[model samples]
Target: MSHPKIANTDHDVIDVIRARWSPRAFDLSRPVSHDVQKQLFEAARWAPSSANEQPWQFIVADRFTSADGFAAMLAALNEGNQSWAQYAPVLVLAAARIEMEKSGRPNQHAWYDTGQAVSMLTIQATSMGLGLRQMAGFDRDKAQIGCRLEPPFEPVVIMALGYPGAPDALPNEKHRAGETQPRARRPIADFVRYV
Candidate 1:
């Protein structure tokens, strides 16, 4: 089962959109299959991007497949995230290719395109009854070193992916509280301006 953190929206949204919310607690016992992971990546593969650059890269490590790789990825997270993210079965580092492949010029939309890809991935995961938490709290230098990422590709977000776990499984009360809290967002009118 996925996290019960559904959005309380004034207007109706599709089930997947309403159901999508990041969760910190992940089921350590449940391992995502390679086939399912492939589907997620496939969804990301189709995201639209400027000039179709599709400038996103990902580094994935699963606890069940490679313990050393998982440990290395875990080390790249900040201490606060490591305390909880360690329980996730799958950890992914998303990156962006900062330069246009052909012209060797900087691609200004690289990060935005990467975010679009991740959003597609997130929706796919939610539809498949999985939950993921995208985190920006990581040591970029450490992640680059651990993944051996070179120029043109830089880390964007580190994500913890797996089945949702019980809130009590969280490492501390603070995180547990955050997990159980109602999801909130600004009203549509506040963020949207219509001419």
Candidate 2:
């Protein structure tokens, strides 16, 4: 069954932008191929960054090729996330380098740039008929340790990536409810102000 939650927009938007929505229900049986994975990251690689620093770094692991690594990545997530995210065949830890590579100064825009990269990744995934969910509900400490992140680099978010699955495939009612519910966003006027 296909569940497409196309956005209700006020103006014209790109198909991929309209089509992108994070899904908690991920197909457990289907694994994203390495070639496809490269394409996703390649999108992120082209994302603009402050001073061309390209602070984003992704630690990727998939159940098929890196089972133990995938388990470790899953363990880094909080229990609630683990409950639902386990079904995703691929797990990713997005990180950012806090310090400027050459200057050794703090880069305030590191997180923002990393987010832009993830945005590109999300659009790419959506175009590929895949689902990407960014979860803030992960343990920072565990992610740092599990992913072997160092001082300059810090965990930003954990992402569950895979093909969208049935809402009933979720482990619990709450997640299923989240999956089947209509998507919502504040009216454009609520967040945007024209000068």
Candidate 3:
């Protein structure tokens, strides 16, 4: 598989946006530095939200120092995902609260707001030469127990972040290919409707 090439564009934002991809294989030997982790969270903190509710909450486990906690969280993941996810230096469980009062006593767009925060963090990680995979194939019940989550906060996505490793180290060739493939997107015409 060929490595994806970054397209040169006038807008600097496009460079960061285009470079982001989910890599399954990671260099487990090198742990993410505290400074970098703090930067990633700082980026998440600034993500736009409805009325600045900042509903997103993150539960992070440093694999090297918190092996037991990390292993417990990994136990809940699907076997396929667990194979690669276990190598990530940091496993972050992102959650958001459902704010009913904000939407006139109805369930507001908490999930949407949480997603925005996740996207921001992912991009920040990517820009810093790290790889990230946002996974949903995990046991929510076990995650809640392992992370000691409280009420009002629901588990949304589990993000694995670390420096990428060789594609050959992955579980299969398909995953390796996926790692190097250029990200595909729906044509703007398909999703955008202009009046």
Candidate 4:
């Protein structure tokens, strides 16, 4: 089954940005290699951060290797997310340090920097021909327990990653149509304000 393409670029854009789209329909049969998984995190590692803190961290739970552990990972996500995420070969909980090391002060831009890190990871996944779906619907407390995350680190987003699967193959009726939906974004005029 062919993966869906939904990007609608208004102007010229890089191929990665043009082709990147989140997919819940993941091919369970195809496994992402450990090397490729490391490469993805390595991309996130290089992201710029406040005071060069580089606080982002990811805890990957692979269904391909550890089904029980993967179940725990899926349990961390909310009910709606669990319905589809269980099919993904990999799931990652993205987190960031809430404080800075040098002065032991709170880093106001930590979350923003962490987001940049995830953006890098996302684009890198695209370049590698993998699909990634970053989700906000997860239980932070459960993830903390499942991933054994300690303080000084926080869970921000859970991403379902793998090869794109046939949307028609999804067991849920609601998501069979998700992969084919048109991609839309607000015009720059709506969000960008020139001071």
TM-score of each: 0.96, 0.96, 0.89, 0.95
**Alpha carbon lDDT at 190, candidate 4:** 94
Clashing pairs in 3: none
lDDT of 2 at 149: 88
For candidate 3, the lDDT comes to: 0.84
Cα lDDT over the full model 4: 0.89
Sorted by lDDT (best first), the order is: 1, 2, 4, 3
**Scored by CA lDDT, what does every candidate get?**
0.93, 0.91, 0.84, 0.89
Better of 2 and 4 by TM-score: 2
Better of 2 and 3 by TM-score: 2
- Model number with the top lDDT: 1
Sorting all predicted structures by TM-score, with the top scorer first, yields 1, 2, 4, 3
- The runs of at least 3 residues in candidate 1 whose Cα sits more than 4 Å from the true structure, single-residue gaps closed, are 1-4
What is residue 28's positional error in candidate 4, in angstroms?
1.0
**Candidate 4, residue 13: how far the Cα is off, in Å:** 0.7
The alpha-carbon RMSD values of the candidates against the true structure, listed in the order shown, are 1.7, 1.5, 2.8, 1.9
The number of residue pairs in model 4 that clash at the backbone is 0
- The digit string of per-residue lDDT tens for model 3 on 1-195 reads 335734333345666776777889899788999999999999999999888888899998888878888888888788888888877888999998875545644337788999999999998998999988999999999888889888678889898889988878887677777776666666557887988
Question: Which prediction has more favorable TM-score, 3 or 4?
Answer: 4
RMSD of 2: 1.5
Which pairs in model 1 have colliding backbones? none
